[model samples]
Target: MARMFRVLGFFTLVIALMSFAGDLTEMSLLFFVQTVVFFLLGYLNFTEKTYILLFWAYMVLSFLGFTYWTVFRMGLPF
Candidate 1:
């Protein structure tokens, strides 16, 4: 689980760099923060269940945030 988190952190770092290159500074900062968090959490000696729960929480929060952004911020003509 820790290894998985580390891998995710690495991927998020890549995303952050790409976003920065694309001039999406806000998104790049967000991903950079997440990368730091995941890396920190990866170093912690947490139980497997805790890690799984944390991952689930992260997923739910991210999904809700994305939904909110699309529905309210995107201003789509619907």
Candidate 2:
């Protein structure tokens, strides 16, 4: 169960990144949804301490990427 959650979280992160890289214009919805899912999965699987650090790093990077894409690429008012 825990391993499955970890795998899902990892894949979510990858999908989020790929979505961002593929189409910044169309990624807003997908990225947002994936991020929310990643957060929920991470929270629910908090018992896995080994991957916690990596997860946090991925979260931070994803957030920064999303912000950058939205504010700079999409030209949305920050």
Candidate 3:
């Protein structure tokens, strides 16, 4: 599980770099924060089930945030 978190942190760091290169500062910052969080979590000694639950919570929150941003923040006609 810790290894998985570190992998995710690496992936997010890549994403953050890409976003920065693309001039998406806000997105870059968001991913940068996530990278830090994942790295921190990776160093912690947590149980596998806890890690799984945390990942699930992250997924749910991210999906909901993305949906909200696309639907409401984007201002597209319904």
Backbone clash numbers for all candidates listed: 0, 0, 0
TM-score of each: 0.96, 0.43, 0.95
lDDT of each prediction vs. the true structure? 0.97, 0.67, 0.98
Runs of candidate 1 with Cα error greater than 4 angstroms are none
Candidate 2 Cα RMSD after full superposition onto the native fold (Å):
8.1
In model 2, state the lDDT of residue 71.
86
lDDT, ranked from best to worst: 3, 1, 2
Per-residue lDDT of 1-78 in model 1, one digit per residue for the tens? 999999999999999999999999999999999999999999997999999999999999999999999989997896
Q: Show where candidate 3 strays beyond 4 Å.
A: none
Report residue 73 deviation for candidate 2 (angstroms).
0.4
Report the lDDT tens digits of candidate 2 across residue range 1-78. 456555676776677787777786466466557656666765665566646666677679879998998888899654
TM-score, prediction 3: 0.95
Ranking by TM-score: 1, 3, 2
Residue 62, candidate 3: how far off, in angstroms? Answer: 0.2
